[model samples]
Target: MAQFLNKLIPTALAIGTGISLIDSSIYNVDGGQRAVIFDRIAGVKEKVVGEGTHFIIPWLQKPFIFDVRSTPKNIKSETGSKDLQTVNISLRVLFKPEIDKLPWIYSKLGMDYDERVLPSVGNEVLKSVVAQYDAGELITQREAVSREIREALTKRSKEFNLLLDDVSITHLSFSQDFTTAIESKQVAQQEAERSKYIVLKNEQEKKAAIIRAEGESEAAKLIIQAMASGPGFIELRRIEASKEIAETLAKSGKVTYMPNTGNVLMNMNASGK
Candidate 1:
């Protein structure tokens, strides 16, 4: 029984060792991932591996995985504008590794290539592009500025074997003093507009007053001519005035109108109350 047990134990141990070796030798490069092999003796192999189960010699070789998928990164930069004003800027970059250069990327920059290259290159491009424009242009010509940065950054990234899918300016800000100056300028503009409106209104009112005075003078002249011609206009005006007075009394509800007799009877009862 002891002899049988010893033989069985060696066989089981060998089987377990074989299983572990096979497991370690096999690896799956998932979708959106690529890999490069690192040989114990040869350092890093030049050949790149694609997504699938791939084999490497156990204990003598290792696989370094890289995500070939596009990833987003935010970069912030503070630099001086062309006008020497300090500005804070933010950028959003979508980046990935160049699939064909995976081995070189792993050999040189390793897993965090984006982290190392993007910030430095991004800041350099941002400062360069921003320095070319005044602080106002950064806001006014924002698209042009972003395009310039994108072009520069894309070119710079390619030199490092990194691929940038998209680059955009996300945020921009200036010093508090500059912001306050802008607000003050806006307020001044509003005040100037208000002043202009007031001047226009006063001029219109003055013209209206002049027109009214001219109309009153013309009416007085017409009245003089009518009076010189005959007394009919004066009599007509008196009748119109009397009619208006009667209507006012009637609307007060304290007088009874006698239309044919041309008389108004006051409500003595209302007057007593």
Candidate 2:
């Protein structure tokens, strides 16, 4: 009876050990076949499935899951321009690691890609490009500045095993004194433009007035010349004036008498002679 109990105990112990081994070392990678990596290996390579359970080696081969989605990095920097004016700039960058280059990225930049590569490259390129522009140009041509920074960052990303999706400048701020000065200069420029337009308008109006005066003078001279050319012209003009006066009197329904001018002139001449 003691020998039978000893054999049963050994069998129970062996079964328990096998179950522990299977549980610890063998894992299903959400596929048909199970993956069994020994407890002494360095790493395991397998494709992970979505919405399914995955497994890894129990004690040796660790599985590090990385999200294949896009991520963003916010980069803030304070820099100076060529004119020694300080500018504050903030940028948001969207990026992702290439899935095919995951192993290289893990080996080279590790998991903290944002912490290690983003700020460094972002700051360096920002400073380098900003140093070449003055404060006024920086304020006016900010889009160009952002493009240059994006280009520089894109070029530098190859070293860090990153792909730059997009880069945008979110905000830019200048010193209080600089901003006040810029505002004042812009206002002065606008005022100057307004004054120039007013002056041009006045000049144009003056030219028109002069043209009108010249036309009136030319008309008066032509009338005088026509009168001097013929003696009957004055008599004709007086007859026309009499007709206009008669018409006006007729319209007003008033009676007008026409005096005999020839007899009055002959009596005045006889008395004088």
Please count the clashing residue pairs in each candidate, in the order shown.
0, 0
Q: In angstroms, how far off is 129's CA in candidate 2?
A: 1.1
Model 2 vs truth, CA RMSD: 10.8
lDDT of 2 by residue, 2-46 (tens): 999999999999999888876765433442322222224444343
Model 2: clashing residue pairs? Answer: none
Error of 1 at 222 (Å): 2.6
In Å, residue 251's CA in model 1 sits off its true spot by: 7.1
Instruction: Compute the lDDT of residue 266 as modeled in candidate 1.
Output: 70
For model 1, residues 1-273, the per-residue Cα lDDT tens digits are: 999999999999999999999999999999999899999999999888989999999989999999889999999999999999999999999999899998888878878888889999999998999999998899899999999999999999999988899998889999999999989999999999999999999999999999999999999999999999998999999999988987787787557756576564677567699
lDDT of 2 at 161: 69
Candidate No. with top TM-score: 1
**True lDDT of residue 180, candidate 1:** 96
